[model samples]
Target: MDLDLKGSKVAVTGGSRGIGKSIATLFAAEGCDVSICARGPETIEKTRAEIESHGVKSFGTALQGRDGEAVRTWTRDTCDAFGGLDVLVCSLSAGGGTNDERYWYRSFEIDLMSATRAVEEAYPHLKSSENAAILVVSSMAAAETFVSPMAYNSMKAALITWSKQLAEQFAPKGIRVNCLEPGPTMFPGSNWEMIKVARSRTYSGVLRQQPTRRMAEAEEIARSAVFLCSPAARWVTGATLRVDGGYTKGVQF
Candidate 1:
């Protein structure tokens, strides 16, 4: 199935590793020019090289995701470098954290605000493209309670609402907006990987819930995400698609 994604320009936040990097890599494999941003310069360069190895143009930047100005600047730079933006994948997140006020603020900024800011900054370029789309990378944790209450889950919930609203507002402008909720995806250096080592009980409990007895791979989630953001899903918008491998129990009527 042709995604009709060749030559499309895409930007992914937190693309240096984990799910974000997988998304960027998949887009590149589809012949899309990819740009990514993350906090680690080394990983940024490494991922950039890997993306380019697929024979597509790749750009990357190392910056703090919570810095609104930096994020906006990176978005602009990517748009300029790529000639325009076709897809914007907001995949950066601060991960789960306890009840500390600081943790809430961190999650709010990194998980929620980064998506908001990237969409705001990329709006103009998106509005100009014939196949503009936005994929907000949320989590199944937003729909179902997993571990103890944490700001990551709530922030992701907020993104689902925001994406729907943005979709409605932008549909007429030809920009499709959608949200993807992944459940317990595991990849190298991912939070789940750390949890598997540091909190075996929690990791095992989550695994037990899945009929597969395993978490989704980064590539698996990325494939679903790219399809939603591709021209193949041109008519799909204002929707929250759960790519959780049945991890979420709620029935969406």
Candidate 2:
């Protein structure tokens, strides 16, 4: 089915690999002009090539996704390349791990503030579009932490709150906003070491908790994100959609 996203200009963060790459690919396939950003030059180029292969106008850049100034600069460059931004997908976030207070601050910068900056930078452009939308990619941990990383849990929870307030503020400006909470998705180059640790912590239990009995694919999460940002979900805003495999319900009992 048509997502009605043709000619839309989109900006995606952390788009070099994993879920970000998946989202960029899906958006390109839907005929959107997509620009992606990540820290690694090699991965950025690779993902850019992949998306451009779909016959969509695509660009990718390597930059620090957490820095506010950097995010603004990247957004300006991307907007210039894409003409204008109609869909903003904040997909950048720090992965598993814990360090000292310095690390905690870094996580906040990368996970929470980065998303805020992206939205802030894209706001004007989004406001210009007739059916503008912003899809903030969060995690199930925002609602149900379970065995997720502590820093991730904290930042994502905050992200949900921020998205709600932003939604309320932007809806009146013709810009819709929503959050997407993706379950554990299996993606290439994923940090398997962390997954191994989580799995070994409670293998059978975690597996059983997921109704699907397996982790999600990157495309699965991307599909939900694309839907939330499309005109199909025009009325969806100031809300969070959980794309988990029923793990949330399983955790209740």
Candidate 3:
């Protein structure tokens, strides 16, 4: 029952809103000092306040994920503020779209490079912790063909692979690595909320495939995420857990 996450220091990227923010706040609820970075200063401050309300220390920075140096700086600042880092959750994303060439660059920089840069920067700090874990927020879209060809799916797929490899490499050093694939998640101001109105047919089509005929809330997915990277799931590593509420049909081997 106890996740044993108290007193841990956590860093979450793209955590100002949606699932990222949910994960950060949940960590704070579990007694972890949490730091988050995102593009919106206002939302970052609001989320920071929310995290601190849980009676844990909170820090936040506003930065675009495409900026590698900014990502690295946030990681360093978070470690400096918290004394050490125990959990790293890469939950920021560029989102999904296929309208133009710019989407490719956006997904690569935000979805892929941000996670890579954060992990690289946090490796040493993680190694020093008694309970170090990393959870990369990949999407179930990466596992199956949902929409048309887009950079978002492929970049997320790369995260799953990289997380597995990192797990094998980090386990020797006492740091665990894992990935989570959330099915279509909807929240106030989420992209799925936009699609529910803008692309009604597409939204309904996806929902019909779900046995529950519903999507997950950010807090719902955050529950699974927090557990995976918490001290409770210490033995879990190099695994990809899909928290899609049976939306995905393909069985994992």
How many Å off is the CA of 251 in candidate 3?
1.4
- Where's the lowest-lDDT run of ten residues in candidate 1? 144-153
Task: Return the TM-score for each candidate structure.
Answer: 0.99, 0.93, 0.99
Q: Count the backbone clashes (under 3 Å) in each candidate.
A: 0, 0, 0
- Please write out the lDDT profile of model 3 over residues 57-77, one tens digit for every residue: 999999999999999999999
Q: Candidate 2 lDDT, tens digit per residue, 18-137?
A: 888899999999988899988999988888888888888887778886678988888888888877889999989887566456667877999888888888788878899998998888
Tens digit of lDDT per residue, candidate 1, span 123-184? 99999999999999999999988798888888999999999999999999999999999989
Worst 10 residues of 3 by lDDT: 92-101
Clashing pairs in 3: none
CA shift at 228, candidate 1, in angstroms?
0.3
Residue 170, candidate 2: Cα error in Å is: 0.3
Residue 165, candidate 3: Cα error in Å is 0.6
Off by over 4 Å in 3: none
